[model samples]
Target: MRCEEIRELLVAHADGELDDVERERVDSHLANCPACRRERAAFESTGNLLSLLGPVPGAGRSISARVMATVRGEDPWCGHIRRELTAFVDGELTEAEARPVREHLATCAACAAESRALERTGDALRAWKLPSMRIGLARLFAPPRARGRLLRFAAALAAACLLLAVGIAFFVSESGTATPPPGLLRAMEMLDPATLEILDQDPGLLEIVRDLELLESVTDEEVALLTLNGSGG
Candidate 1:
């Protein structure tokens, strides 16, 4: 398995959900893949720390209320309200839903206040502080437990950053310099003028900047069809 495959499986492995075959594959792959191992370790450690921190206060209250209402069978609109309110709380609402919610919040004092309260609660919740032990300001004088966790966090962060930088470098080089599929430029000529508006914004030109690769491929396909039909080849 590749690094991405191993990295994804690592979570399951850490949770002890991997079957024997999957476990063996992850072990075999991790032996040859230091980067994936590090990514796995980083995520595991992050998950550990978050679990230790416990759930966010009152994050469940809205859901709990909805569940209770459903049990009572008295609030017919409960389901709709819960789904929309949860999506709005998570900023997952589409533009259409967002407009209605915004309008509702504007005219409805209760919802407007609830929105502010929720925002304030979110800000306050982010203030969850992990206790840090501060030893005397001296090299090699810190408490062992504090020093160990600190070192682990620092190492994980450094490794993660290095991996990200390397990955970005590889992607950039591949996208910018890799040989294009033949007739790519011809396709560019055929894409709709409106579609080209976004491509035109690419300082590297539509074909040159390759970071948004999936989008680039889509544009290329559109352009290629145009180029081929136009050329009658």
Candidate 2:
């Protein structure tokens, strides 16, 4: 089987849930593929860890002694086999690969103890239950008061832009000439008549600038309302 197909079967194979033919296919693949073998080990370890909720007996006295010896660098296979025992018990290893591990564990008191401890850990994992979260993730992270203020500020800003657009559209449709809207006429009157004549020569440019100024004015007025409401605070 391909790596992806073999990976999908790894969990079921580890659990002895695969049929003989499927198990043999995964075994054949694992025998030649070290990367798949490692992934299979991880799946088995995760399954063992999740099974920890169940009541499992404590590790044998020999387990701690062996662990201490391995920590002191007294055993050569200590690190490697400790990493693989979970996979071995799950029957995830091929005969050739598992033989050395079996031989070592038989003679090594410390590794055997380590293996028993792992079995207990797996057992406890099987019985554990995770508690449900009471609040949604977003609500848990952001307070409602802060969220409400932020939403109000955003709504006010949007309302200002929308109102400005509607007002500009109505004025453009009605004026249809060089004459400016009441809002723009007030600002235009402040300029010299020569400047106004030059501005009137290009109604398009004047209209664009007028619309931009109106949008800015509307936005500022909305922001002022937010300030009065203490939303900015």
Highest lDDT scorer: 2
Query: Which parts of model 1 have CA positions greater than 4 angstroms off?
Result: 56-233
* Superposed model 2: Cα runs more than 4 Å off: 1-73, 133-233
Model 2 worst lDDT run, 10 consecutive residues:
128-137
Clashing pairs in 1: 187-223, 187-224
What root-mean-square deviation over C-alphas does model 2 reach? Answer: 33.5
User: What local lDDT does model 2 show for residue 169?
Assistant: 47
Top TM-score: which candidate number?
2
Candidate 1 has a TM-score of: 0.25
TM-score of each: 0.25, 0.26
Alpha carbon lDDT of each predicted model: 0.49, 0.56
Tens digits of per-residue lDDT for model 2 on 116-220? 755544433332221211121233336657433433333333333334344444544465322234563333223444443443333234234233333333345
For residue 141, model 2's alpha carbon misses the true position, in angstroms, by: 13
Taking all chains together, the TM-score of candidate 2 against the true structure is: 0.26
